[model samples]
Target: MAPPLVSLRVVLLYLRVLTVAFLVITVIILSTNSVTIVSQGNSMKFHFKDVYAYRYMFSAAIIGLFYAVIQLFFTISELATRTKNPFNYQLDFYGDKIISYLVATGSAAGFGVTKDLKDTFLALVVLDSTDPVDKLFSRGYASAKNKKLSKHQSP
Candidate 1:
């Protein structure tokens, strides 16, 4: 049977890589997302900055990505040296929990705002079912909103 420490180290590294990958994906999705609205021959573009929640979610993803990368570096170094540092362990424990909560709150805020805008306000106030431009705007809004929601799934 494989040693427990080897298994633990492998799992930890895998999860760290996964976290980085997800954060990168979240950043890419949120950063590139935009919505365009054409009304009465005037066109307006909306981006993540238009919504504070999305901005917050994007910031959290960026910060989390940095933290994950740093942790991954340390984890790799420790594994290669076959040495353990209690201080690093403590930092990892607290950092992981704090980042998780930060990202969770960001996701929740983004989700709530997106839900309200897409389901409640936009449906009733801004969109006209008969207008093709409005349909395009709605679809754009939905795509941006869904991408923002995906940030919550990251570690």
Candidate 2:
């Protein structure tokens, strides 16, 4: 019969796989996002790279993905050999907590940026504008940030 520890390891492996996948998906989504706003016969474009918070979030996701993949490899090796090392236990203990913290901070930064923009610039511009074109402009502005915030749910 499989031991309880083995079952735990299996669950951990599944979680690590999920973490890695989600990080990758989030990174890809953030990379390709762009928004174009037109006001007063002028158009300006913005991208995730244009924002420092989004860049930080992207970096965090990448770092988390790299660590999650390495951890997955280690867990797989441990499961295959049915051997437990003290070093591996320590790493698993600290690594998970650290990565989670990083992801949380990244998500927070993105959320902060989104909220500030939505409440401040977005509201001001959209509310002050009576043009129908400005409504689409407002949606575009919000959509870009919303996409970043949504992708953050994975980790």
Candidate 3:
């Protein structure tokens, strides 16, 4: 006479586990695999700690991991006890919103870094193409940003 609440709960539990796993994987990737290149006797490297964006990525991943653990605890308690608390829905809603905000901020920061780094590396491959490539990138990026700004400003 009712919905499959147990099945729903089980599915949600699995989903939380999957989310934690994904965040852990992202943290690992961001923490390791820093890019290093030797130009002349000097070397340049891109590391998570050196970039704010990568730091955001790491922070988001860690925060998400902790949130997932807390969620798992509440969800497990609910399932085992077969009890529903009025606060669970509100708690879940707020938790989700907090996680979403963190993830979005991290994603935007990561995107900016990714675009700049990708262009820089590509230009590096051409050797001595930096100034011209940078000028071109400046124009293109400026135009794109202007368009985005204008759109956002419009009614």
Q: What is the C-alpha lDDT of each candidate?
A: 0.67, 0.67, 0.61
Kindly give the stretch of ten consecutive residues in candidate 3 with the minimal lDDT sum.
Answer: 146-155
Give lDDT for model 3. Answer: 0.61
lDDT of 3 by residue, 53-102 (tens): 66766687688778877887888997898776989888788777778667
Instruction: Please state the error at residue 74 of candidate 2 in Å.
Output: 0.5
Query: What is the TM-score of each predicted model, taking all chains together?
Result: 0.79, 0.78, 0.73
lDDT of 2 at 123: 57
Ranking by TM-score: 1, 2, 3
Give per-residue lDDT, candidate 2, residue 80.
98
List candidate 1 stretches off by more than 4 Å: 124-155
RMSD of 3: 9.2
Candidate 2 local distance difference test against the native = 0.67
Question: What lDDT tens digits, residue by residue, belong to model 2 across residues 24-117?
Answer: 7777767766666666677667777877887887888888888888988998998899887889877877887777778777877776776675
Per-model tally of clashing residue pairs: 0, 0, 0
